[model samples]
Target: MPELPEVEVVRRGLDAHVTGRTITAVEVLNLRAVRRHEPGPADFAGRLAGRSVVAASRRGKYLWLELDGAEAIIAHLGMSGQMLVQPEGVADEKHLRVRVRFADGGPELRFVDQRTFGGLALADMVEAAGAAVPAPVAHIARDPMDPAFDPDAAVTALRRKRTGVKRALLDQTLVSGVGNIYADESLWRTKLHWARPTEKLTRAQAGELLSAATEVMTEALAAGGTSFDALYVNVNGQSGYFERSLAVYGQEGKPCRRCGAEIRRDPFMNRSSYSCPRCQPMPRNPHV
Candidate 1:
């Protein structure tokens, strides 16, 4: 799945290429593409036909195009989903699900999803924290990179969760945008095990963990986000180079940069968790 950095990178791309362009036509090539738009493809295309994209905004892993009215086109890129801006003459990708052409006859925006788990929705706008976000994303907490992300408030919310710190970090209500990959990296940077309880974390450690998440993701964004496969790319189909800098995630049995101990992978919530056993040891006394 595309994480916060990847989504933010795509948001910036949309701001550059799609913002200010009026939607000349919307072709829903697959019904699954607009499955979230309860009103269906006809209504979805009707709503966006003449609307000009005001801005491209994102909160956590969610991205939306702010239209002229109280409506926006929202999107969530599940695993293998991508948003690409290409010239109209370009060949249609095998997974091209939705295409939005512009009146200016410039580049068109395409939504491609190989797995079909990701979809678009035409949602009414709702104000949350004074930001006009699509209704579905109104509840997602601000991310670490968000200027308004209150570290103190996030710590308070996280401590109240009574869950593993990594689980708490993954909780969108407590703190948005920290996915599995970044969570491992952040915990590795903070030298905290994934199983550590959120309540057991000292205030300093909690703050440091959040800051580490911000640091690593900021670097990933600078590198255009960590791309392990061609499925994850920018609007121009450019791949990121941050995967080369990853320390823990997907580095199982590899030497840890700081401790020289081999990195280990463990099953976590049906997925996997990577950590350095020497650096981020499991808690001796776990919270009940």
Candidate 2:
């Protein structure tokens, strides 16, 4: 699952290469690729042909290509999904699910997904958080990197949650863009245990946690996002270098960079959470 930073990197690439280009043709190689486009593959292809992409936009982990009309094409880049821009004569990728040719006949946009969990959908533009977003993304909260993101409102939303602090942070409605990896990193930076109760946190502590999340994500974006494997890559098929900069996310049994305490991993929501026991002391009444 690509997080906000990874998705943002893709969006930036699309903005640079795909925007302003008119779709000359669309080939849906797999029906599952446009499963969300309800009207079937023919209608999906018909609607996209000849339409120009006005902009490439994103909210949280959702990426979309705003078309000439009020509709946008939303891309769901599930675990192994990728949106690549390749030269016209390049060999098609083995897992290529959708091939989009432009009027310019230069490079083509390809949607390749090995796991087939991702898909494309045409959605009507709807107002969300004062911006025009695809209807499917209307309910999602603005991410920390969004220019209109309100940190104070986000802090209030975090404290309002009765769940553990990390769980609250992972809630997209509370604060978008913080996933499991970044959530642990943010908690570690704030010196807060994953199981700490959100309501127990002071306003200052909540603000600091949000700030840490923003800072870490900003750094991750600069490093092209953390890629642990080949599944996650940019439009040019380049992996991010941020994995080498991670502190406590997957550093189980490793020495903490700050306090020199051994890092530990705990089972969390069918996944894992890593932290330093000494720095982030467990709350007496842990929510977990």
The superposed Cα distance between candidate 2 and the true structure at residue 141, in angstroms, equals 0.4
lDDT of each: 0.91, 0.93
Model 2 lDDT, residue 142, Cα: 92
CA displacement after TM-score superposition, residue 272 of candidate 1 (Å): 0.4
Tens-digit lDDT string for candidate 2 (148-255): 999999999999999999999999888888889899999999999999999899999999999999999999999999887689889999999998999998899999
Residue by residue across 1-288, what tens digits does model 1's lDDT show?
Answer: 489999898899999999999998999999998999998999999878989999899999989998998889999988778999999999999999999999999999999999998999999999888877899998999999888889999988888888788889999988898789999999999999998988789889999999999999999999889887688888778888889999999999999999899999988889998999999998976442
Q: Give the best candidate by lDDT.
A: 2
Where in model 1 is the C-alpha error above 4 Å? 285-288
lDDT measured at residue 250 in model 2 versus the true structure, 0 to 100? 89
Task: Show the lowest summed lDDT stretch of 10 residues, model 2.
Answer: 126-135
TM-score of 1: 0.97
Question: TM-score for all predictions?
Answer: 0.97, 0.96
Name the best candidate (by TM-score).
1
